[model samples]
Target: MVGRLRARANASMWVAPALILVLVFIYYPIIENVRLSFFSWSAFSPEPRPVGLDNYRALGSDPVFWRALGNNIGYAVVSLVFQVGLALVLAAVLEAYVGRRLRGLLRTIYFIPAVISITVAGMLFQFLYDPHIGLVNRFLGAVGLDSLQHSWLGDQDTAIWSVIAMSQWQSIGYTTMLFMVAIQRIPAELYESAHVDGAGRIRSFFVITVPMVREMTTLLVVVTISGAFLAFNEVMVMTGGGPANSSQVLGTWLYHSAFLNDDMGYAAAIATVIFVITLAASVIQLIRAQRRRVET
Candidate 1:
């Protein structure tokens, strides 16, 4: 009995620090945000005034909020396509098509962008997109395609896409690396057997590689979706959700509501919505994966 007690105590001691941090940083803040969402307050307010669901109701009518949500959805779609889908293709090409001698060098080159700091990447893109004396515009002029050049970050029509492009460039390599690891873990014997059966590379990829990497693909999808919803830094640095709020996504909108607009209650409501969305997406993906595992 004493030995069991000592073991339990040691386990508790090992876990308590992490548990305390989660409660303080994650759980407590989530609960408090929910509570705050029920009230109205500004940073200068003496006390938060209970307003029930007024903040939510306002969100329903707020065009800016709708625009932000739409932009986030756009981000999610683009991330799934460029970050996840492109990564999968690149991984397949590297693992299957590339020669052994060049694969390592190519992987390092591809992953270099992922290692760059987001702030620096954003700033770099900002410089690249500048209309006057910027590389992009200069290149367009050199190619005799001057009509395609504009203030990439200043125009409302192009700003959000510009931000999304930067995000994809920075993140695609990380996703590709993950997919490459998944591909490597797949049994080489499967491909060998497929080759014996006269399966071409394309057919083998669809029949063997696709099915084998299903779980990793789903994981990357979930992560990309979550990241899309939480995206702030690129948007903030590149456009400041600017050109008249055309590039505002949920994260930046939330920040604007709290700090710039001083509407703490509304910001909390926005945060709650984002948490619910990300949580729901993650839960759905996990449940689907679990179901697939059971079936297979």
Candidate 2:
């Protein structure tokens, strides 16, 4: 009994640091966030008084909140449609036609964004969107579509699209490189056999490559969806969720409340809701993916 206890104690000593780290970093903040969500706290106030759901109630009536939700959904859909689809297509091309040198060069180009900070990307794009002197309008003018060039980040109607486009551009390279890597791992023999059986490039791709990369595609979908749901930094730095709050996402709104507006408790409530919604969506996707696997 003594030996067993001593052995167990020795084993637990190795886990002690990890447990303490988790308790301090993850568990502590989570508990505090939940606690704050039930109160009304501000930096100015001497106390964080218990408000008990008022923050949530306020969210129910806030049009900005609804707009943010709508924007986030739009962002997610657009990203899935353009970002991941573009990646998959590029990956397919690289797998089917590209040589080793070209593949290496393309891989380098695609990975540039993953290496750079998103904040720098956002700031760089802000300049490119400059209405009078910006590169976008300049291109439009040079192309004779001068009328089409409008305020990219400042105009209400076009600002959201501009931000979404920048985000897609930033994210696509990383995703394409990853997808291409996944596609490369698929057996050359499989393609050779398909070719031997008289399959064309498109046919072999659809018949073999597509099915092979389904797992990778699922993972990318999950990551893209999560990032879409939590998009904040770019919008904050680039747009400030502004031009009449046109591009506000839940993450930016939460930021404004927690840090800018000093409504820590209300921000906590929003964060909790964000967590729940994202969790539910992820669970649904997971269930659907499992069903898909079971079917095949």
Best by TM-score: 1
In model 1, residue pairs whose N, Cα or C atoms come closer than 3 Å (at least 3 residues apart or on different chains), thus clashing, are none
Root-mean-square deviation per candidate? 1.3, 2.3
Error of 2 at 165 (Å): 1.0
For residues 1-296, could you state the per-residue lDDT of candidate 2 as single tens digits?
99999999999999999999999998898788888899998888898899888989989998988888889999999999877787898888986779989888988887788778889999989999999888999999999998898888989887878889989988898888878888879999998999999999989878988788888888888888889989998898899999999989999999888898898888898898888777777887788889999999
Q: Report lDDT (CA) for all predictions.
A: 0.94, 0.88
Clashes of each: 0, 0
TM-scores for candidates 1 onward, in order: 0.97, 0.91
Residue pairs whose backbone atoms clash in candidate 2: none
Candidate 2 local lDDT, residue 24:
100
Q: Which tens-of-lDDT digit does each residue in 1-296 have in candidate 1? A: 99999999999999999999999999999999999999999989999999999999999998889999999999999999988888898999999889987998888988999999899999999999999978999999999999999999999999999999999988998899899999999999999999999999999989998889999998998999999999999999898999899999999999999999999999999999999999999999999999999999
Clash count for candidate 1 is 0
